[model samples]
Target chain A: EDQVTQSPEALRLQEGESSSLNCSYTVSGLRGLFWYRQDPGKGPEFLFTLYSAGEEKEKERLKATLTKKESFLHITAPKPEDSATYLCAVQGMGKTSYDKVIFGPGTSLSVIP
Target chain B: GAGVSQSPSNKVTEKGKDVELRCDPISGHTALYWYRQSLGQGLEFLIYFQGNSAPDKSGLPSDRFSAERTGGSVSTLTIQRTQQEDSAVYLCASSQRGVRGSNQPQHFGDGTRLSIL
Candidate 1:
C-alpha cells in the first residue's frame, strides 16, 4: 500500500528560527513529490516539486530536498508570514492500480514574532 | 487569469438532504479533480476526470457519492442522503494535462465548506 506520513504534526517556532519538516512515503514507481503551503480559509499554494532522489529546490527562505524514501522541507529564518500548514504529496505512476497523489496529514507551523 | 473555482463557499444542510457541489476548472485545462478534506486530515481524492476519458471514481467512499464532468470543462459532485460524516471541505483542482510524465501540477480552489446538521 502506498502511504505518506508527515512528522511533527504541530510546531511552534520563534521568529527567525530555522527548522525542518519531514515527509516519508512508500509507493511504487514514484513520479513526483510536491510541497504546498496552505493558509487559513484559503486553498493550498504550490511551493515546489521534486522529481527524483537527490533533487533539491528552493524559493526565498524555503528549501526542499528529496531522498529515496522521504523528503524534507527546510525553513531558514522563517518569519511570521511563513506560518502555515505545509502539505506533502506524492504522485505515483499507476491509476488503474492505485489512486493519484497521496497526501500527508500536513504539518502546521506557527512562527511567533 | 483565473484559477480553479468552486461554488457556494459554505453550505449548511440537514441530514438526508442531497447536495451538489460544482467545480469550474481553469480555461483550457484538460484534467480536473475533486477531493475532500476533513478536520486535521489530508486531502482525500474523490474523483478525477481527464479530457474525454472515463473518470476514475475509485476513491469515492460510498455508493452515494457520484460526480460528472460536463463538456469537459465543469464538474459536479453529488452526494445522496447526506450524512453527518459527509461534512467536509470539498476542494477542486485542475491540471494542464493528465499524462503521468507531464509533471503538471494541480492548482486548487478556495473550496466549499459543507456542514451537515
Candidate 2:
C-alpha cells in the first residue's frame, strides 16, 4: 500500500526559531513528492515538487528536500504569518493522469511572536 | 488565468437529502480530482477523472457517491442520502496531468463546506 506519514504532528516555535517537518513514504514507484501549505478555511497552496532523491527547492523562507524514502520541509526563522499546516503528498507510478496522490495528516505549526 | 473554482462555497442540507457539488477546472487542465477533508482524517481522495474516464473510484466511501465530467472541463460530484458523517469540506483540484514524471502540481479551490443536519 502507498502511504505518507508526517512526524511531529504539531510544533510551536518562537518568531525567529527555525525547524523542519518530515514526511516519509512507501510507494510502489514514486513519480513526485509534493509540499503544500494550507491556512485555515482555505485549500492547500502548492509549494514544491521533488521528483527524485537529493532534490531540493526553496521559496521565501521555506526549503524542501527529498530522499528516496522521505522528504523534509525546513522553515527558516518563521514568523506568525508563516504559521500554517504543512502537507506532504506523493504521486505514485501510473498511466492514469488522475490517479489521486495520497496526503499526510499534515504538520501544524504555530509561530509565537 | 484563474485557478480551479468550485460553486456554493457552503451547503447545509438535511439527512437523506441529495446534494450536488460542482468544480470548474483550469481552462486547459485535462485532469480533475475530488477529495474530502475532515477534522482528523486528513484529505481523503474521493474520485479522479482524466479527460472523461474515471479509472479509479476506489476511494469513494460508499455507493451513494458518484461523479462525472462533461466536455472535459466541468465536473460534478453527487452524494445521495447524505448522512451526518458526510459533512466535510469537498475540495476540487486541477492539474496538468499529461506531463509525465514531473510538473503535475494540483491547484486547489476554496472548496465547498458541506453540513448535513
Model 1 residue A8 lDDT score: 90
Report the C-alpha lDDT of model 2 over A2-112, residue by residue, as the tens digit.
899998899999999999999999987898899999999999999999999999999999999999999999999999999999999998875553266999999999999
Residue lDDT tens for model 1, B24-97: 98999888889999987889989988889888888999999999999989999999999999999999999875
Instruction: Give the true-contact fraction for every prediction, in order.
Output: 0.53, 0.83
Q: lDDT scores for all predictions?
A: 0.90, 0.89
Docking class of 1: medium
Q: Please provide, for model 1 over A1-113, each residue's C-alpha lDDT reduced to its tens digit, 9 standing for 90 to 100.
A: 78899989999999999999999999887888999999987788899988899999999999999999999999999999999999999888775734377789999999999
Candidate 2, residues B1-117, lDDT tens digits: the string is 498899889999999999999999999887788999997557999888776564478789999999889998999999999999999999999887645734388999989999999
Q: Cα deviation of B112 in candidate 1 (Å)?
A: 0.5
Clashes of each: 0, 0
Looking at model 2 chain B, report the run of 10 residues with the lowest lDDT sum.
Answer: B95-104
